[model samples]
Target: MSSGTASSGAGSDDDHAPWPSPLIRDLVDELRRFNRRKTEFYAESVLEASAFAIMLVLSDGRARTLRELTEELGLEQSTVNRQVNNAIKHGYLERFEVAGSLSRFVRPTDTGREAFHHDGMLRAARIEATFADLAPGTPEGLLRELRAFNQAYDRRVLRETGKDVEATGEHRRYG
Candidate 1:
C-alpha cells in the first residue's frame, strides 16, 4: 500500500492499486477540510448554506425561473423548487408571473436582499480575519488559481458528458 493511502482491510486487489497523484489527494483533502470549516462559520447563520447559495445567485436583483436556478446551481429541479419555496415562506423571496407568460420568476424581496447582504458581510469578515496574517496579495492569488481550476474542471466535465458550454449556458457565467 502507498504510504499515504488507506487500505480497505478486505485485502482486495483494488487495495494495492496505484493511488491518485499526491497533489490530487492533497487537494481533495484540503477541499474537504475547507468545507467543514466553512460549515462551522455558517452554523449560526440565519439561512442554511443551500439557502444562502440560492440568494447569492439572485443577489444581482434579477429574477430567474426555477429552471434557470436549477441550471445555474447544477442542482435537481425538485431541490431548487423546495429551496425557493422555503425562501418565499421566510419572506426572503417572491414568486411572480408575467402577464403573458406561464413561467414564474423568483426574485429576492427587500427583506431578503437585506438579509443576504448582512449575512454575506459577516461571512466575509470571518474569512478575512481568519486569513489576516497571510502576506499581501495571497488571497487574490489564491482566488485566481481557484477560478482557473474551476474553469478547467468545468470544461472537463462538459467534455466527458458530451455537452457543450452553450447548451448548458455555462459560457454565460464562466466565460
Candidate 2:
C-alpha cells in the first residue's frame, strides 16, 4: 500500500480512508487565504490587529475584566494587560475596582464607544464592498461558517490552554 493510503481495515473503502481529508485541507487553506485580506485591512487601517480585536470584543458596552478579555482574545494575560493599560492611557477605557475585590472591570469610555461605532461602520462598508459580487446568500453563508469556525477554534484553544472562554453561541449585531 502507498504511504498516503491507509490500511485501517481489510474491507474499508476510500470513504473512510485517512487523516486530513481533501475537504479539511481545502477548508484550512481557504481560511488562510481569506485571512490575508483581514491582515491587510488591519495594516492599512493604522490600528494593530490585537488592539482592533480587543476593541471589537469590548464594543458591546459590557465591561470585561482583564482576565476575561485575555481568555476571550486568546492572548497572554500580560499582553492583554498591556493593551488595557494602553487603552486607559489613551482615555479609551476606564478601569474601576469591583468594590470589595482586587478585581477590576475595564469599560470603554464615551470616546471609546464612538470609536467602536466608527470602526464597525468602516468594517461593514469594507466587507460589503469586497463581497458585493458574490451571490445573495453567499456572504451570509460565509458569516455563519466563520462563526462556527470561531467556536471550534475557541474550543480547541480551551482544551490546549485549560482556560474556558464563554461562548455566547450568538452573533452580535452591529449597525
Candidate 3:
C-alpha cells in the first residue's frame, strides 16, 4: 500500500466539466438548496413568498407604488402586479391614490402589519437557531462573500453574453 494520500480512482480536476470550476457548480447547488428551503418555509407558513415580500415592503406603514415595489423586489412588473392584486384580494393591502400624484399606492392593513411582524420574528428566530452553532460574524461574512461573488458572476455573464443579467433578473441557459 502506498503511504501517500490515496486517490479515489478519479482526480479532483475536471477539465471536461461544463462549468468553469467545480466550486462554481457547488455554489449554484447550495443556492438552489437555500431557495428550496426558503420556499418550504413560506409554504409551511401558509403564505407565498411573493405575498410575504409585498407585506414586508408595505409593513413600514408608508404607501408604496407598484412600480416602486417591483424595482425594490427586483421582480418583473407583471409579477409585482399579481402579488399586489392577491394581497388586495386577501384584504392585507389597500390601494389608494395620492391627491397630487397619478400613481396609485398600496399600504399594509393592520392585519397585514401584524402578520408581517409575526412572520418576520419567526423567521429570524429560525435563522438564529440554524446559525447557533456558527461563530459570530460568520453569517455576515458569508453574505459579504456572496455579494462579491454575485458581482463577479454578473461581470462574467456580461462578458460572455453581452447581456446585463442582474438588470433583467432572469436566468437563461448559456452555452
Candidate 4:
C-alpha cells in the first residue's frame, strides 16, 4: 500500500472525492463570513462604531436592563458596564434608576445619536450598497425584505401605543 493522507485522497472535483473543491455556494458563504470579520475588526478600532450597533439594537425605543443588554450582546456584565459607562461619560447614554429596582435603563442622549449615525450607520449604508453585488438575490429583493420587516415592526409598535415613535429610534445611541 502507498503511504498518503486518507483525507486528502487523489485530487478530484467529483462529488464523492474528499479533495473536491468547495461548492460555489460554500465558497461564497465562506467569503462573506471572512468579510464580516474583517469589517468588524476595522469597526472595532473606530470606538463609536464598535458600540453603535449594539446601542442601536438596544435603544429600539424600549427600556432594556443591563443584564438584558449583556445577554443580547453575548458579553460579560463588566464589559457591558464599561461600555455603558463610556457612553455616559461621552454624553451618549443616560442612566435611569427606578429606585430599589434591579433593572436600570440606559437611554441614548442627543450626542449619542449623532455619533452613532456618523460613526457606524453612515458606514454601514455605504457598505450595504457595495454588498448588493455579493449575493445571488438582487438588491431590490433585499430592500423589499427590509421594508416588510419594518412595516411589521411599525404595526406592532402602533398596536402597542397609539403613536409609533419608530421601533429602532431615529438614530443609533453610541455606547
Candidate 5:
C-alpha cells in the first residue's frame, strides 16, 4: 500500500521507478505456500482454479458437463475434463449424466462446497484486513483497479492458451 515514489539511479529527477508491483511477489508467495514441498494434499495443489471457478458460476447448485464448465471458464474442453476427473477422485466433486446428454455433469459435493466457501471467506477476510485503514473511496478504487487487472489477466490467458477465463472479488461461489 506504499504509494510513495522512488527514483532509480538511472537518474531522472522523476520519482517513477519501474519496479514490478509487490502484489505479484505477494501472490506468488501465497500460492507457493499452498504447494510447498511439505504439503500432503496433492489433489488440492493440482486442482485447477478454472474448475473451481466453473463451480462458482453454477448459482443453481446443479451439475454441469465439461462442455458447460469449459465455456464458463473460457478454457479448453480437455482441460476442464481433466480437472473434473481429478476433482471427482478427490471427493470434492461428483459426476452424473444428464438425462439426454452423452457427456457427464459435475457438481461439488457438500464437502467440496464447504471447502470452497472456506477459501472464499478466508480470502475476503484477508482483503478486508489488508485495506482496513483505507478510506471508503479507496475500496471502490481498488475494486475498479482489480477489475481492470482481471481484464488484462483474461487477455493474457487468451494470448497464452487461447482461453478467456475470468473470476474476481470476494470469490464467492453460489449460496
Candidate 6:
C-alpha cells in the first residue's frame, strides 16, 4: 500500500515517476492470475467464452440487435459480429428482423438456451465448491468490494475522458 514513488533514474522527477505501489502491483498480478484461471476453466466448457457471454446476456429470452450486443459487451463491432456469426453457424443462435425495423436482432435458439443452462449449472457448482472452502461471508464481501471498485473505476474513466455514460447509453443499458 506504499504511496512513496520509487525512482527509475537518479534525476527522475516525481511527477514523471511511475507508481511503484505494492498494492497496485499485487492487484495487477492477482487480476492476471484470476483471468488465466478463469480462461483455463472455460477452455474445458462446450461453449467458448464469447459465446457463453452472449448467451448469458440473451438468457432473459429477449432479442438484441448487433449494435446493442456490441455496446453491452463493450466489444468492437467486428468482434461481436464474428462471434455472433459463429454462434449462428453452430445453430446456437439465430438472427431475425422485426417487421418494420431494418436492424436484425439476435437471439438464442432452444439448443443455445439448453447449452447455456447446462454450462451455467456447471459454473455455479464450481463457484459454490470454491466458496465453500472460504470463510463464511468472505465471498459476499469480496463480491461487494469488487462491484464498488468497478463502479469507481468506470466513473473515473468516464470523468477523465470527458465522456457521459448516459450519452453513450451505457448507463441505460447497464445501470
Q: lDDT tens string, model 5, 1-175? A: 2332322334443323342544444455554554452223324333346445655665466677777677765568888778778777777788877678888778888777876676556555655786886566466786677567656766787679864254322223222
Q: How much is 27 displaced in model 1, in angstroms?
A: 1.2
Q: Which scores greater on TM-score, model 4 or model 6? A: 6
Give per-residue CA lDDT, model 2, range 1-175, as digits (tens). 2223333444534533353454454455566666775445543353445556777888776888888787777679999999888877877789888777778998888777766667666777887887886567467788787777777886887889866455531234433
CA lDDT of every candidate: 0.74, 0.67, 0.69, 0.61, 0.59, 0.75
**Model 4: runs farther than 4 Å from truth?**
1-47, 131-137, 140-175
**Judged by lDDT against the true structure, how good is candidate 4?**
0.61
Off by over 4 Å in 3: 1-16, 42-46, 59-62, 135-137, 147-175
Which 10 consecutive positions of candidate 6 have the poorest summed lDDT?
1-10
Distance from true location, Cα of 143 in model 4, Å: 6.5
How many pairs in model 3 have backbone atoms within 3 A of each other, for residues 3 or more apart or on separate chains, i.e. clashes?
0
TM-score of 2: 0.68
State which candidate has the highest lDDT.
6
TM-score of each: 0.77, 0.68, 0.68, 0.55, 0.52, 0.77
Which candidate order results from sorting by lDDT in descending order?
6, 1, 3, 2, 4, 5
Candidate that beats the other on TM-score, 2 or 6, i.e. the better one:
6
Ranking by TM-score: 1, 6, 2, 3, 4, 5
Tens digit of per-residue lDDT, candidate 1, span 1-175: 2334444355554443354544454556667766675346465577767778888788766788999899877789999999899989999889999888789999988888888888887888886886796666466787778778767877998879877655554544421
Please give the TM-score that candidate 5 achieves against the real structure.
Answer: 0.52
Tens-place lDDT per residue, model 6, 12-116, is 344332446444555665666666654455544777778888987787667999998988777899999999999999989999989999999999998888888
What digit string (tens of lDDT, one per residue) describes model 4 on residues 1-175? 2122232434555633342444543444554564475235444333454467556665566657778667666579899888888878878888898788878888777777667656665566656887776777766786776567557766777778766334334222223
For model 3, which pairs clash?
Answer: none
Instruction: Per model, state how many residue pairs clash.
Output: 0, 0, 0, 0, 0, 0
